[model samples]
Target: MKRSGPLLTLVAGLLFALFLLALNATTGTRGASSYGEESPAAPAAPASASPPATRTAPPPSQSPSPSTGPVPDAGYAGRTDDDSASVAVSLRDGRAIAYFCDGRNKESWLKGDVKADGTMKLTGRDGAELTGTLTAGERIRGTVDVGGARHGFTADKAVKPSGLYRATATVRGAKLVGGWIVLPSGRQVGILARDGKPSAAPAIDPSTGVVTVDGRRLTARPVAP
Candidate 1:
């Protein structure tokens, strides 16, 4: 019986040791799984930084805007398209005066204001009118109307000694009024009116602007608007 009890105790101790080993194996597996779940994965490398984008400039324009401005104060002179008349214009302080003459029997005087856009409108006696615009070439392009006749004219900018002139005198108890247009070529065309009668005028020195009419001396001065 003693031998049987010792054998039974040995069997029980062996079973208990086997149970402890099985329990330790289960706990080790569970701890290993928990540690793997808690660990974090490394962050993926940041996407390589992209280079700054390049920008291109636009091309320049081929055509440019037109020139524009106000009319300058000066004198302009030219002939009619038909070569039948001479026209003279003077501008001052935004005001304008014009004269149209055929140097023989027909003459008209006009006056008006110059616009900021370089346009002009002038009227005279006997249904006479003139309209013109300043152009890029520093010329006045316009049409003149006199005695029911319309004529186109282009007048260029006039420098010194190439402009309008006027003379007034009395000869033989008659009032004599003269107007002259001295051109850039030093040639001049004028008309003399005696008591409202028109006639071709005598030549005058452009430098001195003086003329002798019927033994009387008269000074021809520059005309202004």
Candidate 2:
């Protein structure tokens, strides 16, 4: 009886040890699986997106325009062959104003339009007319018609001392008109008229604008047309 009892106790101790080992093995496997599930590897980082491209504009261009306007005209003066008739002309912006006279009674104020080609046809009182061409270097060649008489003439450009001058006064109950032209080269020519009749003119001072015609002292003045 004592021997059977010790054998039964020994068997019981062995069975208990085997059960503890099996339980420990199962616990270790479960712990390992839980750790793997809780700490999964971090997902790969997403690639960074690129910035949008920028664009630029261009500049404008520059250019020139053309011109449009009429050409200007110039001045001129001269006398006839016999020194009996004189002429002076002033031109501006294709327009012309002229004076024709013989120191005595015959005189005319003329006006007209000049062409781009320098051609001109001017008319004045008493059916007087002048047709001319303004040549290069400020020269004028023309034909003048007065009272049905035609005369050819050539005149040069008038400058400073060679410009047009005029004088006027009442003498002996008559109106007297006079004109003097002092050439740039110091040459002088003049004409005087009383009541529309041609007569001789007196000596003139170009610088002072003084004149004496028919015993009348008159102050002449420079005229720009």
Candidate 3:
């Protein structure tokens, strides 16, 4: 067989190309190779970047309601009056309500304690727990659920142990009724007597006969007006 130089060269080139392809398969590596075919680098895997850390923010907190403005003290006692010509709590649900009355008649007056920290619970004769809070500026305010409805009230100035008073005396056909009161830091004493007999020491106010070291007073009245 006679060999053509050009034909022989063509055959040599094909063999070289096949050999390179085989070599690439054997290498199995990424990046550029001796064939200069660019290899594609296995698509680079996209580098993954981690989504920029997500940056998720937290939810905001809730704000309190704007009911009775701001309470300065949050531990104030209050006093109020009712339409029944009697004294009632001048505070409720942050306003005012009927205070403890004298036998529900609304006559005379009555007093009770509204404690701080919302623990002093008041119950009606029907035995319903009263709900309230003592707040600033010397006021007690909160809500009361009566008849399954909410009612509001608040007190301003409070009474320091205020109530009725009586005197140690007796008159024919006279009431001769009296009472007394002592403040948180004040002190006074009572002396009982019968038929002008000194059964006990008479309570005497150094200054005003009505006002003693206790700052409370006594009075006598007509039995029938």
Which candidate number maximizes TM-score? 1
Give the poorly placed runs of model 1, Cα more than 4 Å off.
1-67
Q: Give the winner by TM-score: 2 or 3.
A: 2
Q: Provide TM-scores for the models.
A: 0.70, 0.59, 0.27
Model 3 C-alpha lDDT per residue in residues 42-78, reported as the tens digit of each score: 6555665565556778998889643454323222222
Q: Candidate 3, 134: how far from true, in Å?
A: 0.7
lDDT values, one for every candidate: 0.89, 0.76, 0.37
Report the poorest 10 consecutive residues by lDDT, candidate 2: 64-73
Q: Residue-wise lDDT of candidate 1 within 106-183, one digit each (tens)? A: 888899998877888999998899999877537899999999999999888898889898999888999999988876
Task: Give the Cα error of residue 165 in candidate 3, in Å.
Answer: 7.4
lDDT of 2 by residue, 58-86 (tens): 67675643223343455677886566687
Output the lDDT of residue 9, model 1.
99
Candidate 2's C-alpha runs over 4 A off are 1-74, 81-84, 214-216
Q: What is the lDDT of candidate 2?
A: 0.76
If the candidates were sorted by their TM-score against the true structure, best first, what order would they fall in?
1, 2, 3
